[model samples]
Target: IKTAVEKIDIDVPNWTFVAARLFLFDLYHRVGKSTHGIKGEPYCHLKEYLKYGKEAGRLIPNLGEGYDLDDLNDYIDSDRDLLFNYLGIKTLYDRYLIKNKEGNPIELPQHMFMAIAMFLAQNEENKQQRAKEFYDVVSKFEVMLATPTLSNARTNRHQLSSCYIGSSPDNIEGIFDGYKEMALLSKYGGGIGWDWNQIRALGGMIDDHKSAAGGTVPFLKITNDIAIAVDQLGTRKVAIA
Candidate 1:
């Protein structure tokens, strides 16, 4: 694959494009053709993928409640597949593509772009139009959304923001409060960044010298524990103090 990829030059600019298509073919093979009730269709079908995926609990519940799933079919840019490099296509397929019950990729790259576009534009006044506009930008990779948006949008558990930054106050009560906040955010797949500056240094006095303090290290242990406990959706464990 590397050798083939390296051969891509001005003379053969589409080498990576052909490779990505082949890669997508392999991805389709790994999963079943579950487009709604039309199983094993031998081809990609966006609406069917959504209907079946939602029914199977692998997708966001009632994602297409009021929207016309068929409209999305028109917005998909089939040529966008040509834009992906070998690495880009592989990364997306490995990490982002929606899978079926059999663990096969049920949606194509274009379907994913449309799903995210519709999801983000769901609340807009002109949702259908907005979705198309959103799809245009994203499919072309002109503008990038945040990590969670890229990862969770248009999915069963749509935690679409990336990071949460809140300070854990100096006191124990405040620290625990921070823990609760972190837990909630982590549960919804957020990376946490807590302010530890408010807390005292190592071996510092605790509670106005009521007794010797374990300082930030003990508290940090708690933070570390939270990071491990709230491991974000098997994707990553995240926290930064």
Candidate 2:
């Protein structure tokens, strides 16, 4: 794969593209004429794959009965497929490509890349131009979106970003309220930001002792601990943005 990537002189820097391409090449070699429901006669096997994808919350759209295999298979980009290198295709198939129940890849490597680009594009009017830019960035690995964002964006779920922000007030009740909000947001694997300025300083309030109140830090610590306890998606660290 390294040797193959070194051979191609495309205007890109990253090895991810090369790897993805290689993965696709291998897949094609292994199963060139494998009849997938979305690509051939609407086989039960392919339908099962598509069903599994939907059940797993994958962004792949289900092609109903009317959208036969011929229609789905017709949506091909042979030209784009040619652009993939050995490594680029392999990496895509291994890590990024969507697969069926039997572990056969449903979407091609180039198609996956195209889908990502489409999802990241600016808007309808400039979609083509912006999609090109997005493709370039992703193919070159200049910038990669978060896993969830990449996985779910531009589809029905359309929650494109990986993070969110919130603010808490100064008073005790307000502070707890803010924590509650943060907790809820964190449930969705979202990051949160809170301002502790409104919170009063410790030891200084309650009437007087205006000299030193220690301020906001304790509440901040408590929030941090709660975040730690709750955690983010069991994988990503809970973070304050």
Candidates' TM-scores? 0.81, 0.51
lDDT of 1 by residue, 13-125 (tens): 88887777677666555545344333443335666767766876777875666676677776576778778888788888766777766666766777788888888888999
Candidate 2 C-alpha lDDT tens digits along 70-114: 333334344465455565455445655665456665555444554
For model 1, give the 10-residue run with minimal summed lDDT. Answer: 33-42
Global lDDT of each candidate: 0.74, 0.56
